[model samples]
Target: MAHNEKLALLIVLPSLLAGCTSAQMNMLTGKRNKTYNDVNAPWVGSTEEQLISKWGPPKKSYTLESGAKIISYEDMWGPISAYHVCVEKFMIEKGIVTKWGISNCPTRIKGSLPKDTPIPQPTL
Candidate 1:
């Protein structure tokens, strides 16, 4: 191969492999999106009261400039080794949940990933 081609491959190969896709991340975190989505999909139209009833009062709540409300709940029972405590945030408009996001929330894996394990970040 030409020198420039080899250099390009060397740069692109690691870049492509370094970042984990959402699916891969879910697997590593022990969550299957299909099952999780099946269960959670209905929540999109649910009332805020229903959510508060099921989850109890959120750890944090706020209102946005657009008059939408946001509530956040944390799950401390998640896998403790590699992931941080799971945080769920929901956006409520007119008392209904419109959207949500979750981070670092994974089911309890039997073991933890090693601390300080090196992961290559993309060079951009």
Candidate 2:
């Protein structure tokens, strides 16, 4: 109604709309990632079949010389113009999960590696 109020809305509305568009774009492009803190604890000692049933297939996976399997899933957030990503990794040995880690996610799940530790890079 007031001139000042109208001016404020003109400035703020575009920024709000821009943020929504960014999020939507990320989702459509498959750039969005989701974390599962609740499932971390019970995952340890679970078989590969169990992990797949709960979290679905991983986006990428690796196998080490020791026969350990590393499975990873990533999640992304923020506006598509400047998005950030986080990855969760599950280590399975002898068909059972032994440990897991997360990278760049805000909340730390139990059994995650230290924050300073680099995220594991897949060799192949």
Candidate 3:
């Protein structure tokens, strides 16, 4: 093979490998896109300072009995496909997410739930 061809292959091979590794890293890290609005991105690594820099102040703030700081924020899920959305709660302890829970807001439908719609009873 020509010397030029060998050098070209060497460069292209490393570039291709690097691209594949980066793609895999992005997928594993859940960085589907670069945006402050991606709800799927992991929130545990955030510090109070970094969170404020990115998303500003929380809508509400509270402290748990264990002395953990809980900052509440409003996150919209979908205006696109499914058109269903809800606000989620993130539990941050010592600047790390310990747990998360979702609110049971009504799902958007063609029309609002009927006035006569019975509330489902909770089951054990």
Best-matching candidate per TM-score: 2
Q: How much lDDT does each candidate structure score?
A: 0.67, 0.70, 0.54
Model 3 steric clash pairs: none
**Candidate 1 regions with alpha-carbon error over 4 angstroms:** 1-38, 78-83, 107-124
Query: Which residues of candidate 2, in runs, are more than 4 Å off?
Result: 1-38, 108-124
Cα lDDT tens digits for candidate 2, 1-124: 9999999999998787677743364555554322244445457779999989977999999999999999988889668998878787889899998888766765533333333434333221
Candidate 3 ranges with C-alpha deviation above 4 Å: 1-41, 75-85, 104-124
Worst 10 residues of 1 by lDDT: 115-124
Model 2 scores worst on lDDT over the 10 consecutive residues at 115-124
lDDT string for model 1 (26-66, tens) is 56676533422233445678999999999899999999999
Model 3: ten consecutive residues of lowest lDDT:
105-114
